[model samples]
Target: MLFTQAKGRNVIALTTAESLATVTGIAIAPAPARIAAVRVKTRGPGTQVTWNDVHSFGPDAVTVRTPDTIQGDQDTTAPTDKHHDPIGKRLLTETGQNLGSLDDIDFDETTGHIKRLIMAGQDIPGERLLGAGTYAIAVAAP
Candidate 1:
């Protein structure tokens, strides 16, 4: 799901199966990989959660925050560098062949890594990436 759509969903603590948090924001890493982390707000005094530790995702809720899990960094919501946001950027091959434009990203919830790039209704494996910057996302020629 797009980060824009996921912003306000309820965040459920999996261990308790309770709704204790709401997704507040997302942090996109400013590199070719576009690793993303979610920021969640809890109902306690300064209780905030941030990480890619999503257990399951659904239209109604997202399960997260395990009992023995350490909370992720709070400052990951903001980008740390000058790299471009990949969404909407053009998709091209290393040979300069135009494929399409990036539409969304699919990530691995277990490892917090980007798994694929969704572009023009097609799935491009993250391993095919060559570079992602201000211009476009270049992948290996297929």
Candidate 2:
């Protein structure tokens, strides 16, 4: 499913129907190009919902086993470790040619594997993903 499709979906607690947070965005770990963590409107990690914390990514909602799964601000403190979230970052070639801004990502809902990246209307396969940081999302030159 397209990652954009998940934005705005409610984050639900598995033990109850209560809404914990709203799906706001995600951090994509590049090279392998997978969703490293899901960002939510709430939760203690300053909007982060680590992959390990997610119990399931359902069509209607994202589920967590418990509220504790929503981490506090105590995880990895390195700023460099948080550079992979690439929603609106510019897309660039490995040689430094600008492609465009990344609009969205197509990924497997269950596995979190990125399938392709959507920029404008073009689909760049996930394997072409080279790297991601706050500056740009790099892809292999065609």
Candidate 3:
């Protein structure tokens, strides 16, 4: 599933399947896990939630944080890890063939691990990726 699709989906509790909050954005860490946490914008005023404390995630929603205690993070604060915003970054093969700009990321819904990169509506396998830098994603030649 693409991260874009996960955004805006209602976050439901795993145990009860009860609605908790709405997803706002995701924070990707530079670590091997890829997705470090999720940020949720709750329904009430002054309420927000972060999924950093949670350990488990499903395809559609996460199974953490209740509706009442979920608090929001400072809007200006950024994630503390080294990260890259892949969207709009150019995609290139090892031999320098231009594919397209990155559109979205495809990830494992169950494990929260990034599976592939979506560029020009195509799926590029994670293993083919050589490097994801500030300007472009270098992939192995086909």
Candidate 2 per-residue C-alpha lDDT over 14-78 given as tens digits, one digit per residue, 9 for 90 to 100 = 88768888887777776677887887777454456788678899888999887766654356331
Q: In angstroms, how far off is 36's CA in candidate 1? A: 5.6
| Residue 35 Cα positional deviation in candidate 3, in Å, after optimal superposition | 1.0
The ten-residue window of minimal lDDT in model 1 covers 74-83
lDDT of residue 104 for candidate 1: 76
lDDT of 1: 0.63
Question: What's each prediction's TM-score?
Answer: 0.51, 0.86, 0.56
Ranking by lDDT: 2, 1, 3
Global CA lDDT computed for model 3: 0.62
Which residue ranges in model 2 land beyond 4 Å of their true spot? Answer: 43-46, 73-84
| Best-matching candidate per TM-score | 2
Supply the TM-score for candidate 2.
0.86
Instruction: Write one digit per residue (lDDT tens) for candidate 1, span 19-121.
Output: 7677665444424454554556665532334454567657678777673332445444443123455667798998889998988777655454666778776
- Point out where model 1 deviates above 4 Å: 1-83
The pairs that clash in candidate 1 are none
Could you give the C-alpha RMSD of every candidate to the true structure, in order shown?
5.6, 2.7, 5.2
Question: Would you list the clashing residue pairs of candidate 2?
Answer: none
Assess each prediction's global lDDT (C-alpha) against the native: 0.63, 0.78, 0.62
